[model samples]
Target: MDLEKPARPPAAAPAGEGCLVVAVRVPVRIVVLVLVVPVRMAWDALVVAGRSLNDTLLRPLGRALPWVGRAVFVWPFAGLWRYVLVPSGKGLAWLGKVLVVLPAVALHRHVLTPLGRGAVWVYARVLTPVGHVLAAIGAGVRTGALWLGRCLVVVPSAWLYRWVLAPVGRAAVRCAKGLARLVETVVAGIGTGLYRGARILLVLPALAVWHRVLAPVGRVLAVVAREVGDALGHAWRVAGYVSIAVGRRLGTLLRRVFVEPARWVHRSVLTPVGHVVRDAVLRPLGDAARAVGRATRQALAAARASVRRARADLRRTLLGGQTGAERKPQLTHRREPNGPRTRTLDGSTTALTKD
Candidate 1:
C-alpha cells in the first residue's frame, strides 16, 4: 500500500458540479435557463406591477387621509347633536344657533381682528403719505395746466392777429382802395357819357323851347337863367371830387391805425407769451410726468418683488422636501446572497467559497 499521504480526496467538486465518468448525462442547461429566465422575469414584472399599483392607489389616499381623518373625528360631535341633543325642532334650532355663534366667534378672533389691525396700520403708515403726495402733485399739475391753457388761448389769439389777421387786413384795405379807384374810374366814365348824352338831348330841347317861347321873351332873362345853371353844375362837380378824396384819406388812416396796431401787439406780446408758456408750463409738466413715471416704475418694481417673495414662500411650502405633501422620501429594499461571500476590493460581488 503506497501510503503516500492519502492523496487529498480530489477536491470535492464545486457546489454546483455535475456527475463525471461514464459520460455523466449533464442535464440540458437549456431547460434550466428557459425555466429560470421566465420565472425571474415574471417575478420581477409582478414586483414592479405591485409597486406601481401601490404608488398609484396610495398617493391620493395619502394626500386626503389627514382631512378625512379630521372629518371622521368631527362627525361624532356633529352626530351627537343631531341624534341626541337636537332631535326636536326647538333643539335643532338651538344647535344651529350654537353652530353659528361658534363660527362667528372664531372668525372674529382669527380673521376680523387681524384684518382690522392691518387695515388701520396700512391706512396710518402707507395711505396717508401717498394721498398727500398725490394731492400735492395733482394740485401743482392742475395749476400748471390752467396757466398753460390760458397762455395757449391768449398766445394763439395774439399770433393770429399779428401774423395772420394783420397782413390780411392790410391786404383787404389795399384791395378796397383798388376797388374804390376802379369804381371811381367807372363812375367818371359813366358821368362823362351821361353828360354828352344829356348835352345832345338838352341842346335840341333848348333850341325848340327857346325858339318857340324864349325867342319871344327878352334876351336878358334867358341869358341870366343859363348863367345860374352853369354855376350850379360847376359847384356840384367840385363837391363830388372833394368828397371822394376825403373818403379815400379816411379809409387809409383807419386801416393803418386799427390793423397795424393789432399786428404789432400780436408780434410783441403773443409770440413772447407763447415762448414763455412753453418754457414755464410745458417744461414743468414734462418734469412732473417724468417723476410720476419714475414713481410708477418703482411701485411696480416693489410689487413685483413682493410677488416674487410670495411665490418663493408658496414654493417652499408646497415643494420643499421636508414640509411638502407631494415630496416624500422613497424606500428601497435590496437582497444579498447568504453564506460566506467574497467581494473585490472595488466592492463588486464575487463567487462564494468553502474553506
Candidate 2:
C-alpha cells in the first residue's frame, strides 16, 4: 500500500470565455477587492468582539440564567405545588369523590339503573308489541295505496310515454343533431381564422422580438452578472486571506508585548513569593493556631472538670445527701453455699460433688 496520497489533477479552464468576459473580470475583481476588504475586516472585528462578549458576559449569564430562573420562577411554583397546592388538590379530590361521585354512583346504581331497566322492559313488552301492530297497519295501508297508484297513475303514464311522447322526441332529436352539425362547421371555420390571425399579428412579432432583441441583450447581461459574481467570490476569498494575515501579526505583537511578560512575571516572581509566604508565614501561623487550639481545649476541659467537682461538693453539702459519684454499686448476685466434699475412690474430690 502507498502511504502518500495521490495528487489531484488541475482543473481545466472553461473553453468558451469571450474577450468581454475577460475584460469584465479584471476590472470587476479589482473593484470588488477594494470594496470587500473594509467589509471583511469589519466582519472579522465583529466576530472577535462577539466571541469576547460571549466568553466574558453571555456564557456566564447563560449559566446563571437557569439558576436564576429556577429561583424566581420554578422553585416557588414547585414549593406551592409540593407544600400547598398538592394537599389542597388531594383534599378537593377526596371531597368531590365523597360528596359528588359517591352520590352519583349510588343514584345510578339504585335509582337510574332500576328506571332504565323498567324502561327497557316496557319497550320490550308493551311498546314493542304496539309498534309492531302500528307498523303492520301502516304496511297494509301502503300496499293498498301502491295498488291504487299503479292503476290510476303508473299505467296511464307508461302508455302515454310509449305511444305519444316517443315519436315527437325522436323528431326533435333529429332536428337538434342537424343544427349542432351546422353550428360545429361554422365554429371550426371561425376558429381556424382566429388562430391564423392571432399567430400572424401577435406570435410572430413576439418571437422576432425575443430572438432578435431581448435574447442578445439578456445574454450580455447574464455574462456581465456572472463575471461580477465570480469576481465577488474571488475577492472575498482574497480578503479572507488578508484578514488572517493581519490577525496573526496582531496576535504576535500582542503576545510579545504583553502576554509573554505577564507570563514570565507570574512564573518567575509571583510563584516563588507565594511559595515563600506559604512556607514561612502561613505554615508557621497555622502551626501556632493549632497549638493554641490544643491548649485552649485542654484548659476548657480542666475548667469543666473543676466546675463539675465544685458543683458536686456544693450539692452534697446543701442537700445533706451523698452525690451519685460517692455511692457504691450493690452486688446483684449471691454466692452459692458449698456443701461438704465427697470422697472418690482415689480419695480426691469431684467438682460437682464438692460444690
Using Cα atoms with residue i matched to residue i, what is each candidate's TM-score against the true structure?
A: 0.24, 0.46
Model 1 lDDT tens row, 58-89:
77789889889878887887888788766777
Residue-level lDDT tens digits of model 2 in 121-199: 9999999999999999999999999999999999999999999999899999999999999999999999999999999
Model 1 accuracy (lDDT, Cα): 0.84
List all candidate RMSDs to the true structure: 52.1, 21.8
Give per-residue lDDT, candidate 1, residue 120. Answer: 98
Q: Clashing residue pairs, candidate 2?
A: none
Candidate 1, residue 18: CA error in Å?
A: 99
Q: Each prediction's Cα lDDT score?
A: 0.84, 0.94
Question: Which pairs, if any, clash in model 1?
Answer: none
Instruction: Give the Å shift of residue 291 in candidate 2.
Output: 2.9
